[model samples]
Target: MFDSLNGNQLKKESVMLKKASIALMIVFLMVSVCSARVVDGVDMPETLQVGDAILVLNGVGTRTIAFVIKPYVGGLYLKNAETDAKKIMMADETMAIRLNIISSTGRGTMMNALRKGLRSSLDAMGGDFEMIRTRFDAFQEFFPEDKFEEGNFVDFAYLPGEGLKVYKNDGFVGLIEGIDFKQAFFGIWLNEPSPADSDLKTAMIAGDVSGEARAAQGQWLAKVDLEQEKKAAEAEAAALAKAAAEARAKEEAEQKRLAEEKAKAEAEAKKLAAAKPAPAKPVPAAAPAKAAAPAAATAVATMPAAANNALVAAFLVNAIKTSEQIAVQQGKPFDADAETRRILDMWSKIKAEVAK
Candidate 1:
């Protein structure tokens, strides 16, 4: 079913298809080049004329907030590309920091960010810090009373004698006069060790980012992570120390509790003793006849004066003992062991008084 074309027809068709493909590719490349040069919807001029000198676009980047919202896109222009921030600030050549506002509601936020940036940059230079802060505070008044809306352009340009010229959307906002102030102002977005500024400064310095700048950036990130780990370790140690102290307190409390319990047990034993009734007096033994000479003499000699009233009783106990012995011998009430123990207990009490 092939309506077979000639070899010449097939060759011409293939060539036409290839030409169409090439045309499309060329158009796509052109579009990409055009768009790539534009920054944050604002097209940057290749050269910017400030006063008499022309500054070139050294680098461009977005100022992102919280890694999500972009409040502005910033571009740095310089007479010559310089990666060292101090050199850029002190070059005594014309340079500009251009910002295209992308968020209308972030004027206060932007101001705070600028203040923080200025502080960060000023911290690097160790002289007249209070003067530097005062200068930047005055510089803040140059902004419009109304918060900056989207699409507004703020440009800061520095010339040797003219100082820092401020322009808002191509209109004049006035200038702060001094190279000293210029260095601190530009530092806000050009200094190192900053989360945003370092990257932006590096990109701005070299139109095409170099490996050296990236390396510095890598080291900064590593330092940040290291500091975070150190803080985490300190916090963990604090928690452990607190726990150990709590355990020691609990152990001491338990020991005290056991001591109190032992004291209570001793008090209870004393109370039980105090509650007991006194013993009843023993009954007097039966009366007896006068004994033999040996027994009488021993009783009179060993007896105490305290037992003067009990002599009769002691003699009666001896009589009872004799009766018990007689009863045992006659087998009438034969408990010899009990009878002897009773006689010994009675005699021992009387003897204890005598010894005392």
Candidate 2:
């Protein structure tokens, strides 16, 4: 009894020890997880007015951050903050202007996050992130102005062999030898020329050149010749219509000829059907022969054995011929005589009974 009691106490102690060890392990794991460091920093104003510098724990390793002073809520506000802070502030003020720092680390982190998020979002949106970046880059290069506005007309003329001339108000601004508008606006940074000054230059040189003498001459000649060409096209169309009508009439005559031939063939088929003999009917069983006459004698009297055998053979041949006719009618070819001979041999055994 004492030994059993001691064994029970030992088991209880073992279980308690296991629970304590498990609890200690769990605590250690939680502490280790809590001690890990993440990317942590404070959000501060990105830009400051003249003589104003905001101190921010710069995750990008920048010491001082500058900001532009802008009016907000009837008071002066600073612009050019970190993206996170800007997003939070802009959530309330929809019309607020914010400047992006565009640093290497900042852009990289933001772009990585954007890519990860867009992988799922892009499927729903039906576009790729790479395409979105490419389009954004193109938009920045093409139209650099903050807001688009209408400008005066600028005349750009390309000579036959000479370079292109840009004009504003009858004054020549510049000459371009080989410039492509699509490449200038849509090409990558390494290949495309800067467009910052191009817009301004184009705006200044608007409405400069008069119409070219050669261009005016070509336009007038094209207009006069176009009317004459239209009249010629109408005459040609009329001639074509007459020829088409003649061809249609010929086609109708040919169709009528084919119809008459088909009717004649059908009538010949009906005449042949009428001339063909009808199939022979099977004979009914004869009444019992006279009592005095033997069965064999009576059979011989009703039909000669040789002739009866021949008639059975003929009937079998007719059956095979009918089968062949059915196959032929169904667009299949068959050997009628070979099948008829096969049927005669098969019915030879039954010929004696049939003759009787």
Candidate 3:
């Protein structure tokens, strides 16, 4: 049939086919743009530009607490759309997870949720916990603020060789390096027995971009209980009060302990003081004695009057005894008067010497 056709017909047919192809492509593009996946009324773009790579939307879901408190719309973007959870999680390719916060989610809550989920995911995957935890802690540091407000888009974009880059809206937060970390982080959403909601995990992997799914998600997300919000606020306030009171009590207890320790130390010091011995009083030195005299007369002169008298008496007694012994040997009765006279003379001489 082609051999029978003329050149013009061939050219015309070629032009028509090209036009049809272009029209089909245009329609397809329009449908793609118009059928943007909506999660909780937020239109999630089909493609995301991360670094130098353009990523297609793999799945979309909402993070909720008890299926009522819708906090954020989570969308996974990859270089290729994949439904296989493990494959996507383990792949070291350019991918991203966009979290469009639709409610007032506290930073602490999100951080805790992420840490718990990522750790559980890594645990199930079975790998080095220290490495996982180190990276996980680093990832948590990206969010330093208190709360992710409504309309905040927090993105975790994984660059092939550059690790995971985090962004808040238009601002670049920080990066966590390593493929091991990236795998565990992605596993939080894709791992089996994941910490995320079952339905949410399914939606993220399967990516059901249907009107029904969107409508239901939006309606469910829109259901906000004012009483619940108020109660949560009151509860938060109460917790803050309790923490403050506990801190005060702890400080007071510490102060009391210090005071008691000081008092005990002082008491110990006083007891030690009382048990100590007193110092002895100083003694006065004695006066040195005078040098003795050389001669007997000089000695008698220096002596006290009573001492001199006693010495003279002792000499006189000795002389008298000697005289009596001499007389007994040679008729002492005949020499009594003579002896008395001699003794008298000697006494007089001794008295004179003592006076001198």
Backbone collision count in every prediction? 1, 12, 0
Report lDDT (Cα) of residue 174, candidate 2.
Answer: 54
Q: Give lDDT per model, in order.
A: 0.66, 0.36, 0.70
Among residues 3 or more apart in sequence or in different chains, the pairs in candidate 1 whose N, CA or C atoms overlap within 3 Å are 59-204
Pick the lDDT winner.
3
Model 2 misplacement above 4 A: 1-224, 293-356
lDDT per residue as tens, model 2, 1-356: 44455455555545554554555454444322111111113122221111121111111111122333211101111212232321222222111111112222233443343344334344333435564555434323332333322222223333323433444323455544432321221111111122112322232123221123223333434444544454454455455555556667887899999999999999999999999999989889998864343222332343324656677555555566566666666666777676655555544544756868
The local distance difference test score of model 3 is: 0.70
Candidate 1 Cα lDDT to native: 0.66
TM-scores, all models, native as reference: 0.46, 0.19, 0.48
Which residue ranges in model 1 land beyond 4 Å of their true spot? 1-36, 208-356
Candidate number with the higher lDDT (1 or 3):
3
Superior by lDDT: candidate 2 or candidate 3 = 3
Q: Lowest summed-lDDT stretch of 10 residues in model 2? A: 70-79
Model 2 residue 17 lDDT score = 49
Sort by TM-score, top down from the best = 3, 1, 2
Top TM-score hit? 3
Estimate the Cα RMSD of every predicted model relative to the unseen true structure: 27.7, 36.8, 28.4
Better of 1 and 2 by TM-score: 1
